[model samples]
Target: MKVLVPVKRVVDYNVKVRVKADETDVDLANVKMSMNPFDEIAVEEAVRLKEKGIVTEVVAVTCGLAACQDTLRSAMAMGADRGILIESSIELQPLAVAKLLKSICEMEAPSMVICGKQAIDDDSNQTGQMLAALLDWPQATFASKVELAGDKIIVTREIDGGLETLSMALPAVVTTDLRLNEPRYATLPNIMKAKKKPLDTIAAESLGVDTAPRLKTIKVSEPPRRAGGVKVADVADLLNKLRNEAKVI
Candidate 1:
């Protein structure tokens, strides 16, 4: 079986985000970058499946600027066989991204595709579902555990109330949750080897998909800063404030 995992590059989670002075997007100047944490888990799962002899090959793919190659390399270092990059500088909406991925899926025709539940930067949990819809394939989102049996895939998902298991046929899509597995760090040797791995770059327009931005960002602003409150000396002071100034009691 061939497994395709989609990865993404985003701002490092530890970075303190700042809005651009123009208020159009986040200020990325001098910001550190890393693979989206969820995508790392997706790549790790694909690699583990290959290591266990459950899958024959693992392919990592990404869509974004050239910098996204870093994320692809990170996946390759984690044991994906090769990488495909859909190069685009403009930001793509979920639908556009799904359309591009659908094009690649048609060409690759992998047995299964895995991706993060959401990108940390955007927090838009739509790409995996949209890709599944475009491909007309079974989908298991927020999967905490995944196993293969015969031609079927069993997925344990984290739902609102608790966990739920679902079975889907081959050529399905699975979006991973946090507890799927602890992602492994790339060893020094693996990181060096990843540089020699095949990393193909393709133009987004070449896929014949509309890579246009459908949504407009009308305004961007920082969230209000939290204010520090005075500590009351006793229950009487707290009650008095709540009953008078705060008017909550």
Candidate 2:
């Protein structure tokens, strides 16, 4: 089975994000960017499947600006056999990305597709489901554990109540969660090897998928600073504060 893993490049998790002066979007000038942490888990899971001999080849793919090639290379260094970059400069919303991945799926005809549940930047956990809908394939999201048994894949995922397990046949989609597995760091040798791995770039338009934004951002601003807690003299003071200042009562 050939597994296709889609990764993304996003603002580094450690950096303090800033809104642009115009309040249009996050200010990315001179800011560090890296692979989405959830995507890292997806890549790690795909690589482990390959290492276990369940998957014959692992292909890492991304749909975004040219910078996403770097994210694809990072996946290669982690053990992907090759990389495919769907280069597009347009604002890539979830549906646009899902369309691009659907195109790739039709082209590559992979047995399975793994994706990060959500991008930390947007926190819009919609791509995987959208892709599955477009392709009409079975999907499992927020997966904490995945196992391939015979011709079926079993996924254990987290839910508000507890854990839920799902079994799907080949050619299914799975979106990874944080608890799936820890990603291995790219070793020096692997990094060097990744440089030589075949990395193919395709113009997003060439895929014939419309990369258009459907939603408009009204504004982007940082949340207001939280007010600090205040001490009270006794129960009566606390009650008074909650009933008046806090307005809870």
Candidate 1's residue-wise lDDT over 1-249, tens digit each?
Answer: 999999988999999899999899999999999999999999999999999999999999999999899999999999999999999999888899899999999999999999999999989999999999999999999999999999999999999999999999999999999999999999999999999999999999999999899899887899998989999999999999999999998
Q: After aligning candidate 2 to the native by TM-score, how far in Å is the CA of 122 from where it should be?
A: 1.1
Q: Candidate 1, which segments miss by more than 4 Å at Cα? A: 239-249
Give the lowest summed-lDDT range of ten residues in model 1. Answer: 211-220
- Lowest summed lDDT across 10 adjacent residues in model 2 is found at 63-72
Question: In model 2, where do residues sit more than 4 Å from their true spots?
Answer: 232-240, 247-249
Question: With candidate 1 superimposed using the best TM-score fit, by how many Å does residue 126's alpha carbon deviate from the native?
Answer: 0.7
List, residue by residue over 114-225, the lDDT tens digit for candidate 2.
9999999999999999999999999999999999999999999999999999999988999999999999999999999999999999999999988889999999999999
State the displacement of the C-alpha of residue 142, model 2, in Å, after optimal TM-score superposition: 0.6
Per-residue error for 204 in candidate 1, Å, reads 1.1
**lDDT of all the models against the reference?**
0.95, 0.95
